[model samples]
Target: MLDCFHDECGVAAVYGNPEAANHVYLALYAQQHRGQESAGIASCFPGDDFIIRKGQGLVSEIFDQSQLALLKGTIAVGHNRYSTSGKAILENAQPFVIQYRYGRLALAHNGNLVNSDELRAMLEHRGAIFRTTNDSEVLLHLIAHCNEPDFISVLRSVMSQVRGAFSIVLSDGERVYGLRDALGIRPLVLGELEEGFVMASETCALDLIGARFIREIAPGELLIIDGKGYESVQLLPKLPRTAHCIFEHIYFARPDSYLFGHWVHDVRKEMGRQLARESHIEADVVIPVPDSGIIATLGYSQESGIPFELGLIRNHYVGRTFIEPKQSIRHFGVKIKLNPVKSILDGKRVVVIDDSIVRGTTSRKIIKMIRDAGASEVHLRIASPPTICPCFYGVDTPTRSELIAHNHTVEQICTYVTADSLAYLSHEGMFNAAGGGGETFCSACFDGKYPVEFSGMDT
Candidate 1:
């Protein structure tokens, strides 16, 4: 299996700015990797209802000058979505907007709620209608139906009933709000424009728009920004332990982004350094799988004193669909994305570095491709521990049965991938590399020790 890994969503919001919609556009553009299934933006002029433009495609494909022009506002919220709780269809594209009894509200969310299916069932029993399958829409429904005096009370009431990771940004036709889960499993950062504030899923989005890096939105904090200014209300108490998703550093986040108080690139480099310390070997050269593997490979090269080469070249321009030949070709799907550099790999004892190996079939194909390019031997080194559990906190991970390492040993995976040797970074080394990035970071995918309690979620 060619593994599929995706972080479900990213959110960006702006308040009290003349070009708020434009800022959100750039933020979503910078975070395009978070979700490619759909892109959307919601904007509203002061005292006006929201104007939302949403569709299925990359951010660039969905948004342009005319579309952005139509969304005129000083308050805006935007979303890039790869669904974990819903289908990947135009109907589920977000910043989900609705006109409720209280007022016009729009929401864009990152991360998943574990109890959403149950909540949807209960709400449906009570005659609540749902427009989309997205779990994020559940929060809006709860808030609208609550018998609360104010918005903060509604948040206080609903946030306790729902469980799991969520970093949300919403616009209420006037003010913008940012909310993070009690466990902080997903990241949300606050930034500053000259005239207003920006809330985004990562600091990289802030950087793209020349916004000053502020601080991460604290766990369980609800930040509200309005005409007078912004204020923080503790919607829920912080958990005894934080559950920041460790995979964000391992693969999901852009290398340039900073999450959980650590620079993602630097953390990945340290992960490679630690892996090298644990699994160094005699090799003529070290090569990476490309893209996500590049930074970690640099650290592996430095730590192991092995020369690093771009032995595998990636075709970044390849589209989601391309015409293939009528005749069948082996590994055609992988070959279209990555090709080996024979001159760099010929007669070499190569060490290949990657973030992680999911199903191992792709690694097998890659190793064979390297051998076809005349490599003498291929050794695989992973930057993190073997994944044995499925992620229920917004990451799109395979089922336990589908993960190669769930039941297979390191040696078994090595044989399956046709590598001369295989090794994985230790859990101790991973946390040590992060310099205690999170005292309670979630590593359920590696160890099967999920922080949040759930039923029938193992799959």
Candidate 2:
């Protein structure tokens, strides 16, 4: 079963590479964890018509050898989308391509725009026809309708209208561009490929294509790359305080990635160590909830001096949709997705480490499964603080009323999850271990301090 929190999106672009589309496919595959809803790629040689391919499926399911071969070009841009602002439909699949005065433009965006509703209404009033419900499309409209003298000027004008988290990659058939919001609420990095340059949502995408990590795109920086080379311009001024999404370290990003000026794996391990220090229980063995929880579990085991064990195994082949029989099946899907190791958990005082508890339903079900597998005592340790608020940036989360921690105390959550003891990493521990002060990162999901105010937007 997937966690309650949904990932934002992933983006990649390659310029000056003969196999630009192929490299982008590999990049999207590496970032499949970030999104599974839809995938797309657009490519073109300098002064050529763009070839665009998009589908409502996984990256592997959407593209194959023939499709990649047909996307012949030395420049490309790709996106893997998990929509937070739009309905799931073919119309909403990204790499949103359009023909305008500048010829062809394709854009893929990875964050939510808080003022998109107001902007959309304004645009519609001005006879702007809309295609998809996603806020990302608004960027394309803004760029197309700008009265600026040049492309850079157009970008600066558009950046002023949109407000919120955005890490976007776009192509105009000849060049590739990458940019992040002024507050830097998301991750975007540049990489050096042997034949070209790469920009993607994470360094892991670069690693998969054998590209060398260069550096993270600075907040408000816009990077433009073409056959000649690449250059950067600060289209938007840096705010007094930057707000990098902290969930990237806790659960959203791949552990192998380096994000927000720190190694994601190192930051996660530190969170686990800090959790161990905050809440310690006498237990026989420490077991992780599998995959996402494994790294932090190592740190917990190291600090707690408890032997680390892989008590839960996950099946990765599960898709977003599953057919149910006429009769409802109880615990069948959960078992198929994650199964506990009886040998490791039987007759032992087991401590289970997980990323975070959202609705508490999955955590409850998992705890029940562990007990059924013969664990005598189960203590649950969460790697991050309780999610008490909704994220307005990019994460798809339940409302505040739906979040268990919003209404219940720690003792109540423990009882609801049916755990002997439950503990979450403190907010201070998480921020400190992540190596930043409150001004450097966004903890809106934890503390409800939104860096970008909703009602304050220009109307």
lDDT of each: 0.91, 0.91
Which regions in candidate 2 have their CA more than 4 angstroms from the true location? 325-327, 456-459
Q: TM-score per candidate, in order?
A: 0.98, 0.97
CA RMSD of all predictions: 1.2, 1.8
Task: Give the Cα-based TM-score of candidate 1 against the true structure.
Answer: 0.98
Writing each residue's lDDT as its tens digit, candidate 1 over 1-459 gives 135576678899999898999999999999998999999999998779888999999999989899999999899999999988889889888999998898889999999999999999988988899989999999988888898898889888988989888999998888899999998889999999998999999999999999998899998999999998889988898667788899999999999999998999999999999899999999999999988888889999999999999999999999878998899899999999999999999999999998999888889999999999999999999999998889999988889899999999999999999999999999999998876634569888988888888888767
lDDT of 2 by residue, 1-459 (tens): 255699889999999999999999999999998888999999989888889999988999999999999999998889999989989898999899899997789899999999999999999998899989999999998988898998989999999889989999998877889999999999999999999999999999999999999999999999999867889999898789999999999989999999999999999999989989999999999998887788899999999999999898898777677776767767776776898989999999999999888899988989999999899999999999888898889988888888899999999999999999999999899999999969999998888888899884221
CA error at residue 12 for candidate 1, angstroms:
0.3
